[model samples]
Target: MSGQGPMRVLAAMSGGVDSAVAAARLRDAGHDVTGVHLALSAKPATMREGARGCCSVEDSRDARRCADVLDIPFYVWDLAARFREDVVEPFVAEYAAGRTPNPCLRCNEKIKFSAVLERARALGFDAVGTGHYARLSGSATGPTRPVLRRAADPDKDQSYVLGVLRPDQLDGALFPLGDTPKAEVRAEAAARGLVVAEKPDSHDICFIPSGDTRGFLAERIDEAPGEMVDPSGAVVGHHRGVHDFTVGQRHGLGIRRPAPDGRPRYVLGLEPVSRTVRVGPVEDLDVTTLSGADPVWLVDPPSGPLDCVVQVRAHGGTAGATVRVTADGVDVALAEPLRGVAPGQAAVFYRPDGGGDVVLGSATIAATA
Candidate 1:
């Protein structure tokens, strides 16, 4: 491993402090680097609404400026059609089927690692580098094989979204910001004279910049008004669409009557065919066992039970679990119940280690109990 030669790396510049600094670090390490920004919308917005969204004209320009400062070649790749096909449309379809899909995870799986990495290899690059907060074991050049691990910054760990990646994808990938915290990244960007040093991180979903998800969904899905029934099968209220409610939703149940025991009602389940939203006491939301499909194993496919920690959402809670690999998916029995885990959400697995949890595998939750 000593006296390793410099590698060719294609850095993804997202016009943010982290990405700008990531590109700088790669160049500082003497690797041949180039910058690229993804244009995710066909007709990109002229500017971002503060820190609400990204991939806008302003963001592209920012990325280009950073590339110029670093003296690296830069280009914008148009991936709007691919994004719509892979992330957006499937999001709508999943909601229609009464599932809560994670679009960011889908974007990483289909767009960045799949679409961009394929193109990068064709152009004679060694690996596709990003500002993602995740780590890989073994060599940094990516060819020696590496196991994905959690970032040093636990609060910003992005391993959950990246759990879908296969061994081939990991082979030519680089994450320079995995070991650094967010605060230090910003300071580094400012010291490097990057213009986006203080640019606040975009918080909302990219497509829905308005931050009104319900309004956006309502426009795409037709209203199928239905009843909101209690656990005992008694009608308590009504709603316009099953798409309007997700499991574990507490407010806006439209239930005029209160429970006999005076407990707050939460959405327990959705029946798309019946157009029914099941409302019940909060205790019903606690799910202990999860059955999933589309399993992606970063480790060897285990034939028996494996002890691991599982995360149900991007920034939500995680719990200790025992996982059994199934023929097509996984059976995870949680050590403690997690509230409101729904279908179409990823169940990312990690094995507890010394520094941070090492990503083992992931799957799409198909059913929960």
Candidate 2:
């Protein structure tokens, strides 16, 4: 790799400190780097003031300023239509069907790696660089065959959201912040005179900036009043819609009376067709086994039952499990019972090698036992 000539690279700058430093690192490495900001929303430019989300007009401007400072060519590519079709619409539909969907995973699978990488390849770029906190390991001298691994900074590791990327996508991807700590990244940004060095990290779904997911769903999905019953078939209360609730949700039940055992009630199930929300004790949420669908393997699929660590949610803890890959998906037998395992959430698998946590792949949870 040392003797190889300069490679043409396209850096996707999100107008954040992490991406700014990622682009700068590529340029410093003697790669022919160009920065591109993705315009993901069609909202008015004036709406970006003090916006606490990524991809805003202000974020694009910040990216441009960083590119100008780095002395690299910069351009903004509008992807609003593609984003709505691939990520936003599917999110509403999954919620309507009483499933909790991860829009970030969808964006990684469809927009960033697929749409952005494909476009870059066609434009003669050898690889696309991003600021995600995930590591890649492979030979440095030959053709790159990336093996996805967790970031050195465990708190900021983003491998869960990126587990949906395929092997082919990984070959053309570069994550420069994988080995760098967030604090060091910020320090580097400041040293480079980048303006977004002190910007706060954005939280919650970017589309629902208000953080009112239930209210957002209500606007898109029609209100369907239905019965809220206990596990014993006794009517407890009523709900506006099943889409407004998810498995293990406790608040907003509208039930004034406590359970007969003086215990708190939780949402156990949701029937979209009948619009029924089932409430039960906390013990009902414990699941020993779970199955997922539409598996995406970064490497080769396992031949038989494989022991791995399973992560059910983005910010949730991992569990030791024996995974058996099925024809349609994979079945995970947890070593201990897991609570609040919900459908439509990703189940990312990892193996503990001597190196570190290696990402095997991921699938969407479909059922639990």
Question: Which runs in model 2 stand beyond 4 Å of their true positions?
Answer: 1-5, 44-51, 139-144
Each candidate's TM vs. the true structure? 0.95, 0.94
Residue 268 local lDDT, model 1: 92
Q: Write the per-residue lDDT of candidate 1 for residues 39-151, one digit (tens) a residue.
A: 99998889989988788899999999999999999999999999999998999888888898989999989999899999998999877888889887656353465688888
User: Can you write out model 2's per-residue Cα lDDT over 101-165, one digit (the tens) per residue?
Assistant: 99999998899899999999999998888999998865333575568888899889998999988
What is the TM-score (0 to 1) of candidate 1?
Answer: 0.95
Clashing pairs in 1: none
Report lDDT per candidate: 0.87, 0.87
Collision count of model 2: 0
